[model samples]
Target chain A: MSELTVELAGVRFGYGAAPILDGVDLTLGAGEFSVLAGANGSGKSTLLKLLVGLLRPNAGTVRVLGGSPTDPDIRRHVGYAPQGLRMATSLPVSVTEVVAAGLAPSKGMLRRLDRKDWTRVTEAIEAVGLGDLSAECLFELSGGQQQRAILARALVGHPRLLLLDEPTTGIDQRLRPALVRELRHRADDGATVIAVSHDPDEFHEVCERILVLVDGRLQRITHEEFHHQFHEHGAPG
Target chain B: MSRLFIDFAIQAYLAGAAVGIAAPLIGCFLVQRRLSLIGDATGHLAFAGVAIGVAVGVAPIWGALLTALVGAVALEWLRAKGRLAGDVSLALIFYLGLALGLVVLSAHGGLTASSTGVLFGSIFTITWLDVWTIALLCALVVGAVALFYKELVAVALDEETARASGLPVDSLNVLLVVLTALLVAAGMRVVGLLLVAALLVIPVAAGARLAHSFRSAMLWAIAAGLTSTLAGLVVALLQGTIAPGGTIVLAAATVFAVAAVVGRRAARRHPRSSAA
Candidate 1:
């Protein structure tokens, strides 16, 4: 078996009285690109949050990188780009500064950024093709450009795993392909990637495996199965 | 000018300047986060502190500062729990503090006259002790912002992302609330509880419309704040009867209105510039 990057066994979680995820058993291996497909409120975001240690499961274990979800060391090796990008866009922050925030976890409170940090930030910005707009304020960028900048933030630290929650929500249709292509390129460079998406078409070409969340239940599927199920249901307008 | 008039003007300017500088310095973040009402809540809490201190014949400033800080921390904790909305939590805590203060004051037999000073500040009664306290608090607030500028900015812009990036998002958030409490406490003596929120929000809101960067927004907000306080103090002094707090708030509101108009016109002229 391939080395396990994430392993969740019978994990259950809920917000208040409502149960969102129940008995979710899943595993992701090293060097794998997996797409999580689910309808709204199917616990996709909750599951991602659980994996990243943002939330704790009520029952069972959630292990990422051979440690508990709350392990700081494991979290250091994983990067998460949340679905809520509105907060970053509304603030008067520059693209470069946003990307540089990804470097925050590794540095101490008083630690100053050195030349090496700048190099990493520049490389990450260039990777997302936002080098030209690095100095531009984030609120000034197009939605797709902003999404790319967020993606660059996730990739800057060269994390062992990347977890993106609904990354293409507000992205422009024309730029979708390029963004997916860039993500695929990063995965090709040997980083384990797990992305949650509502649209099967957007991730079909890039993902090697598919996991579907239906009413909080997780079901593993092949690419063909995902395409058949998703296409059969038709797209949401 | 007579020596007495000059002394009064200098004192008003000094006191107003201290609050003017501190309020918008903290307000920039508060306005951006849509937590402007929090300043109002903290200001009311400071009133409660002042009431309690007056009942005991202790220094009202100490009581006000401690209460405001505690209230600020409570507000943060409630928000973090995800149980209550920010504004609702603030309102609930604010009323509770006020009720407690009222009870404490009444229990000590009829309201203390000193409580009125907190309700509507007396700039003409400016004391050296109050000036020293405001100066010390201002230094602390400014120093904290300067030292943690980058980390604070990162968390304020996107807290979840900041946490993911490894920033101490929670601690930074708590620190921000503490600093805001300190600002409110310092301003309470100069602007009064009811008018203190104006100093915390109006200048920052106006500056936000004009400035293109976070740093610029803060700088502009500080400049607007200082200018309005100074101008308001002069106007109040000339009138000889108007309250300094009311004049300062009016001045800030006028600046905010002007900024809004200018910002809208500029945006229309430069359609491509994302001037947020």
Candidate 2:
């Protein structure tokens, strides 16, 4: 078997007494691209947050790259693109600046980004087809363009583990395939990729596995099984 | 205009210029973080500190600096502990500081000319020592911004992203507030405790509307700040009746108006290029 890049056992968590995720077990090996599906408030994003160490599980352990997700050393190899950008939209940060910031975590405090890091930033921008708008303020871009810029930020670091929440949000339909192709490329390059997406079928061909959150537990299903289940349920609302 | 170059006027100009340069430099982040009013809150707390300093016979600015620093830390602590929302914490500090300042000064023998000077700043009142102090603190603020520009911008842009990426989000937050406290205290002599936040926020607002990028926004903000301060001083000098703090804030507000108009026209001309 491929080396496990993520390991979670009997994880339980919630905002309050009522648990959102209970007795959840999941593990993903390197080079595996998995898509997580769930209804609204089914803890899909929360689970991704757990994997990124943004939230801690109330019970059980979450280990990524043989260490706790909260560990900075481990976090250095992780890239996360949340569903929606959580920044003040009014702030005049350019696409290039935002993508460059993706390198900030790995750079640590006080160390400046050298030329190599900037080259990586530029490459990521080019990869997302945003090279022309690199200097434009993020807020000035159309919704789809902004999403691509965020994707560029996530891709800039070239992390060994990439977690995305609704990564295709606001992306143009024509560009969706390319985005999925990029994810597959990252996974093929030995990165562990997990995406929490409402529409899992978009990733059907590239994803090796699909997991659905039902009543707070992960139900690992094959792509065909998910397709059948999805058809039967008329897809998650 | 000829009197503007005199030793006393030059000292005031230096002090005002320093505040101008430093306040907006730090204000760019604060504005981006939606903590623009933090300057006002800390300024009020610094006012209380100045009162305490006078009550105990210390230099008022030093007292303001110490109190503002402590207040800044306390505000962060309260927010982190989830005891109060950020705005509530700021409001609490704001009212408490002002009231405490009022009570302290009233009990200590009423509001004197010097204490009122702290309220409504006068450019001519600045000492060479005040100039040096403001310059030093301004220099420190500039150095900090220079050293941590990327980290600061990253944190301000998207705090969660910055944290998830491995930047020291919490420490950087503290540094921001600490630097804000320093700027508020340092600016009190030129713009006074009440109006210092104007220097901190208005210029950044104008700059953000006009500039296309964060770097450009910062540059524009500093330029606007300097313009407001220097112009306000000259106006106050010419008028001789108005306070420099009041004039400085008005000048900044004027700059904001022009930037808003220009930004609106530009956005109209290029709808796609305009910021949301």
Write out the backbone clash pairs for model 1. A105-B165, A105-B166
DockQ of 2: 0.61
Candidate 1, A91-115: lDDT as tens digits:
3677888888787676556677789
Worst 10 residues of 2 chain B by lDDT: B267-276
Task: TM-score for candidate 1, please give it.
Answer: 0.87
* Interface C-alpha RMSD per candidate, 1 decimal: 3.8, 2.6
The TM-score values for the models, in the order shown, are: 0.87, 0.96
Candidate 2, superposed: residue stretches over 4 Å from native:
B86-89, B273-276
lDDT for position A107 in model 2: 80
DockQ of each: 0.32, 0.61
Report per-prediction Cα RMSD to one decimal.
3.5, 1.8
- Residues A1-237, candidate 2: write the lDDT tens digits: 899999999999999999999999988899999999988999999998999899999999999988988888888899989887779866588999999989888887778999999999999998887888899888878877888888888889899999988888878788889889999999999999998888887998899888899889999998889878877867763
Clashing pairs in 2: none
Chain A of model 2 scored by TM-score: 0.96
Candidate number achieving the greatest lDDT relative to the actual structure:
2
Most DockQ-accurate candidate: 2
